[model samples]
Target: MYTSTPFNIADQLPKGLQALMYRAQGAMDNEASGLQRRSFLKVVSASGFALGAFPLLTQAQAQAATPAAAASALKPTQQPSAFVHIAKDGTVTVTINRLDFGQGVQTGLPMILAEELDADWRLVKSQHGNADPAYADPVMGMHLTGGSSAIKNSYTQYRELGARTRAMLVAAAAAQWGVDASSLRTREGVVIGPGGKRLGYGELAEAAMLQPVPEKVTLKDPKQFRIIGKPTGRLDARAKSSGGQSYGIDTRLPGMLTAVVAHPPVFAGKVKSLDDAAARAVPGVKAVLRVPLDRGGEGVAVVAEGYWAAKQGRDALKVDWDTSTVEKVDSAQQLASYRALAQTSGALKYNADVSPLATAPKKISAEFVFPYLAHAPMEPLNCTVQLSGQGADTKAELWLGTQMPGLDTLAASQVLGVAPQNLKMNVQMAGGGFGRRGIPSSDYVVEACAVAKAARTAGLTAAVRTLWSREDDIKGGYYRPMHVHRAEIGLDAQGKILAWDHVIVGQSIIAGSPFEPFMVKDGVDATMVEGMKEPYDIPMRLSVHHPKLNVPVLWWRSVGSTHTAYVMETLIDEVARSAGQDPVAYRLQRFGDKHPRHRAALQLAVSKSGYGKRTLAAGRAWGVAVHESFNTVVAYVVEASVKGTTPVLHAVTAGVHCNLAINPTSIEAQIQGAALMGLSMCLPGAAITLKEGVVEQSNFGDYQVPRITDMPTVAVFIAPSADAPTGLGEPGLPPLAPAFANAIAKLTGQAPRELPFKLA
Candidate 1:
């Protein structure tokens, strides 16, 4: 195994208004293309950002654009009672409605608020909010941090929150001076009255609380924006970079016991027998208890004074795991099964005619495979649970970094036998989640609560923290599903798509979850076929098979685009080559005028990259790819070369169009980290393979992650827009692998059919 320090980009780095339809409010960000087939919303392919802009901001921005309106009704959840807090020291703290697992919403959302509040940037700070109804997304009506909707969905809400606070502060200042509120103006935390009278927001904060909260207030226009578009540094950047930051794993409670679970080797396997004689002999060992696991299984947890003692105690225990009931998944055999299924007609997703395929001038039949991937966030999954009292009077507190705090709270409360209202969730700073910590089952959280409950039942009164080692996190269940995409592509004489017949085989991510009714329709998982067609208009028959597998899978970053973008882009490049045309030009021609955002993004990357103007070294070639995910578009123009069997990415230039650039520096960091992660897909040993129902790889020793040296020189440039920002987190990742594959294809004269590049 190679040796290296953990390359954690999380420590290092970094929407418009339109429809009010329920589908728009609760819709997935990447469904701009899926609108046509979706029964709820009519598809408007010609208009990209207009149709999918954050829907709640339409009337809010219009009415709130003015300084003050006749007081309108404010939903209890919309009031700023819990969000904006001012200290006597003039420190303005903004509470973010979502978790900050390195996406910089901890800073970005505050920028939106502080901008509208006209607060001094130097004095503004941010903190993560709890699972209160006040923090829930107004549109989705949930405590969610995914789909890049934090700023997009909350822009108007935060603006109004800031404006209302400003209004109340002005009203307080005006009443003190016996002047109308309109006569006073706010500038950098100060209310300026007639004759240069001024007061800091700190002095008026308490008095401002007594004033009526305004429902509508003015928002600065794009031209008047001083902080919104400015490339300000992240509030947490210094703490993160300086190693002074605290994550959930760093929590230390009084008399808290540390826990390490000895999970069954096979998923859903049960512990046949567990002997804790040696485990109990360990000096710091407190207790050894068998607890119920997620998926109706059982595991033994070792509770000790600390993590090291707990782990040692766990290692000393003897456990017998029963694998008889669970399915033994073999990667080789599974691939064979998937390939076999791809040959037949599966459930129909799109029923476009295939008659043109038989009569087309040329045809290309290709099959691509993608393997399961672990999230592997820098901090392994963990949760600290403190239980007090019992039964109906039970009160519990949990500390963790969670994407879906509300769901996790519900799950933990149920496991701990505490009422949901009695459970207090402290949203902690997370190293990174990338979608692992947001499981619908709330697996880790539930397991922690279960361990605490078992400990309490066993007479241990202290709180318990369930900690997963790096090995456990890597081998843990929720992984990106393995996928096989088989396609028959037909091209006319002009190289336009005559027909595309496609079949995908993979496990459904949302099948058994509470979201199954909404996310899975007509037996087709919506996440499986997201990135296919449009952005380019192509007629095709799309089919899918969601084989139920024993392994649990969740939405990894960018979800379906992790595989779909690779298939579509590589195949598109191949078709472009066959047609003797430039890949970028071909994609541009396909984009036409229907998608101006895509066109602008591609053009920006092309011009900034000097694609045709600069001459590359003989060994290196320019590679290009563009994709839209989470409603954000990212285009890459890369310079790449091959060294032996490995692909070497030399330089990358990204053209990002998420409408508005809230923080260009943060956007750059996200792209760099995501691209490096994408490069990991092409490295040897990247796949999370399984054999005999046991994970073949455990930790970084066996798995391959990109090292710092492997990172290319990435340059990011944004295409500016006045429209609201869209998702920026996952879009950067999807196009990176396909662009690298396209580059390697140019060097080898043959495209890679699988990830981790099996080149000869």
Candidate 2:
């Protein structure tokens, strides 16, 4: 049970003890670390604490002599037990363990606690929780937040926490009044007893905390939830609307210098020689230092008084790089080779193939290829670091908008030669992560720390923050692997799918990467598992994952589903047409009532999109597709009209259903945004090539995203569910490409097998 005494660093304690506490709390703004300068305010707002509770819990947990005692003491601190502390004066403080980027987790998360805690929701405060293994998500198993797992993972725990706290508060009031606990119930912000006697939660916080923590917490049924189902105003809405919201880029320190690393054009290349004299001569260029790459990465750094100065100085510095190997690797030819590789047979089998690739009455085969894509988060990649002086004891602090805070802490500690405990990592609001934030084996943070250490002079290492320009970030390493999929399906006499064989050839996103230790299994990456398996019951279905060895691949927005869904959904349409059946009706026959959510999505989209109805507008047709990811199921129906030279999608109807909605408004925004993002990838976001490698496109200008003019009018609907919450962010994305492509096929009278879904 959480005790509600306001935390006070006792003044009578030793000065050193106070300093350590203050440092750990991250409240010492006078001599802030690199992390403080780059992300202090941002982290404070995004996570809602000076620092997270992990360190405080770590300090307390370490005092236990036995593991059992430590476990007992922790007790997982059920949501009601930890969320929303009430003070004597009535200040309601809410604790949020979920990480927030621009996704509004900071706002949505606290709303759940406020709803059940029954505190003055208007005055509730918020804070971020620290990383702890015990607090690790039951599904993902780490004190981290991504994959749209925030609400889904915390939904039940937090609601239970709120209800339990309400129970505790009611019990406390009942005890004071000498009445039965069951006779008292909560309404609004006060506890009301049988005789109408009442007391605010603030008046009973200390006593409530002393109550025994309940082992079994009962959450309120959905029927009684007040704040969850309805759309309430956002918690951070006022702050954001008033422009008081601080993003990572707005973080700054007193003596902080802006730093920018000059990354090698080619992967794994190094600087043979560099002249920084001209850079040193440039105004505002405080210090010009070259830091060696950590591990087997590529780069050097340039520090200056400001961002523009650092970028200018970096551009002026002469660098001769070793790009001998990758310079000759042509992206166009390499992609073609990967396509060829898809046809070959060496691949790790995931699902056994009973398919008729070994001779059948009718066999249809098609090859589909996908292009590389950038995460292109609204906020580009950036980090701030401050390294202390020499020796293994040298401490480094980092402030990065990364998804995996624990991983950042470990990597930064290793690079700085300090124990992980001594290192501080502050996670700021990522402009966006989309799986790009938790990339393994990438030294983006380590390089910044190394540069800070190398810049040390006179017992003072450099306080540097690195910023990757939009251009640099888009062209940067770590991208979604372009893949080639070879699909062969055999149909019986009635055109029912009997044998299905799918071979996927792509760079392993985890193989040989830092995540290899965790994500890889027997050389088969499960990232290829999503759309690779036949959701429908196919008697003979075989899925093979052929890992394209060279090049680095990271999980994109939809990860494997981005590629696999395109193949499966489009092929399903082909088979439906071959059988002379309606696409929606045919798919429905394959699915049963067992998957209520999946069926709901199909039915909702079919009805809303007028699936079998005629299009009044000439030259326009509608097409539909459905896919499931991160436990959430989505179906998309697109209405497209051929514009003579290009296919222009005019409207779309989408249906999604996750278990519970912490914030209906935010979930809607995420679904709507994800749909547009997926649409752009299918049409304008294409990677072209030159004589050597990728060329022309860099940022939004060359590689266009969806514009206001091109955006389709979308109608989104949510299906209700009674199970555990599923992810909402990415599931809405995987179906857009196929939905749009299928529409194009109907209009053009040709099934388009590749992207950039153009008729020409």
Candidate 3:
């Protein structure tokens, strides 16, 4: 999904060229260290061609500086599109700034640019970008992919890149023909001249490379778009389907050793004693050394020839963990504390006078508890690191599927004792991340760098690949914070909300993060209260209490909306039911004129799903919910049944208003994937709990994700619009659980207050 924010791109060259320059300088430095000078120019010639295609600097100016001096002058203001390459074969390769990670961005972003470039779809291809300053999110000015901001932030930038490249190609054609550039027009990679002369983009590529870059170019009107709103298949879909795609876990480097760490059961716990004799004696075990862990802890890393040997060596290792300095958190105790805290308002966020609640004719009080959830992406976390040289000459290179590659690069540089400029990050395709890969701490990446550094200190010269088993990933500390919500609502005879008082208790996801100062304000984490009383007009008091627990918590798929939407939507349904009004009508009436997108999405789902017109079968009911997150609105009309006390979702029809759809096929897939994940949260054993400060669930056997049998039939529909695209990855998720819960509540005459529903 794309973000809807604009960014600046006028001050520099692309990072690919800068990286080439750096490599050139490194080659010179390696020669000084008694190493034979490698052919750096040949190594970067392909990327140099792409960069040179965009005239950031004239030939004279570029020739004036030595390669090393030019490298030093390359800064962080570079634009990403400078690397867009038009190959001699007519293949237009556009490098994406964000990780694809199964989100279809590899194709969706290129679709935007190719649409404007008027390139033939068959000749278009895309590649993953590295952790370079040029790849930073335009609005955030950082390398990040969370909040579904990829497409929204880069839509215009990429379009302009295409427009500018087209303008240059036209200019080049005009110079060759001795005519005004306006006499030439492009269509499907061909420059059509006034006299009917035609030239393929491939024939004009070299000349286009020499033409001056235009400062501005007119973007095509939405009405003229031949690709932006079209449904296009993903470019990597065939590769992934044919099992030819490589993810982070599939990364392999020559002379690379695999490592697995034995972390303390309790977070931030230190090793009291160690016995690595058995580990070291294990066959293929090259080294066993203690390394610093994330969140201020220490762990033992067993480096071996392969993953199996590393796991075997890790299993053989024994160490006494010291937990005296860390707080022991038990899930049962924490829930009790959260429950008690939710009973009273802690810090006031929205202080509406809910004094009318006591005098209202109708009142409802509800308390909802949501447990911690692990990201549990299909591919477990893994990072491969290779270090060269030492001191200031030390250069580090990392290969991983990172959501924030630039941040990870900086973090890895610190861990490897190298300057950030000396580090290179190769972003790989990720199986799935949700929000786990975008952590502010860069925990997994830092840990991998630590293991590589430890191996280097242990006299090992090979690259180190740090891998986490499925068990290790589940037991990993970062999780969605457990939350408890208390709500008191007063409604009139017509189900109009008079006053609503709500209190939420959870650990702050951004409290200790570098984003804390900006994301947290006035004793409240903005994410903690995002979806409360939204998309509908209401007077309410919302407060929050963030407890400092030992459990490490991070944002899940939709952040706070994962829990908030369920609370608000389900409760609103209950209020409508109590007043004897139809849920959809009640919601529509309350939507009021301010939220047309919300009303449109809801109406579309209802009309298309036949929610009000078609009668459900016996024991099944209609479930409806709408929510806006990441600036996109999604509404779900679902059919659900309580099958012998277990809720079974039969089918779902989604109406999404992301403004403009780049690739409707990709949007549909994202919604289906997100919906399934949302349903996973309601399944039994979905919670991540702690006992004596240790994660109780280790793998799929204990921690449950949705199985094939649990998948519901889903249909997706997009609301028509020419507005810029917002986020699609997360908005599809927030409404799913609430819609399901609303149907179950209708069937059982009970409003479930906690996750992993226990109707039996």
Task: Give each model a TM-score.
Answer: 0.91, 0.87, 0.92
CA displacement after TM-score superposition, residue 468 of candidate 1 (Å): 0.3
The residue pairs found clashing in candidate 2 are 48-127, 54-130, 79-161, 80-161
Supply every candidate's count of residue pairs whose N, Cα or C atoms clash at under 3 angstroms. Answer: 3, 4, 6
Per-residue lDDT, model 1, residue 368, is 95
Candidate 2 per-residue C-alpha lDDT over 1-760 given as tens digits, one digit per residue, 9 for 90 to 100: 0000000111133344324333433432222222332233333333322223334332232222134323433334453433555666656666666557666677776777667776676677665544333344534444456666777767766666677677767878888999988788887778988767888877776556445445465666777777766665666677778988665666686678887888766555677788888887888887776666533546767778889998889888888877666544466787777777777654465555554656666677888877777777888877788776457667767777766665566667666677665677666666776777776553577777776766665233457787778887776757787777787788865668777766777777767654455445565566765665546777534444554533456788778888788888888888887777778887888886556777888788777777777554888888888988878888998888778777787888887777666666777777788888888777745653333543445788877677898888888777765566677767878888888888877777666777666467
Could you tell me which residue pairs clash in candidate 1? 15-724, 15-725, 66-218
Better of 1 and 3 by lDDT: 3
The candidate that achieves the highest lDDT relative to the unseen native structure: 3
Give per-residue CA lDDT, model 1, range 312-375, as digits (tens): 9999989989889889999999999999999988888898988899999999999999999999
What is the C-alpha local distance difference test score of candidate 2?
0.67
* Cα-based RMSD of candidate 1: 10.1
**Which candidate gets the maximum TM-score versus the true structure?**
3
Ranked by TM-score, the better of candidates 2 and 3 is 3
Candidate 1 stretches with Cα past 4 Å from truth are: 1-72
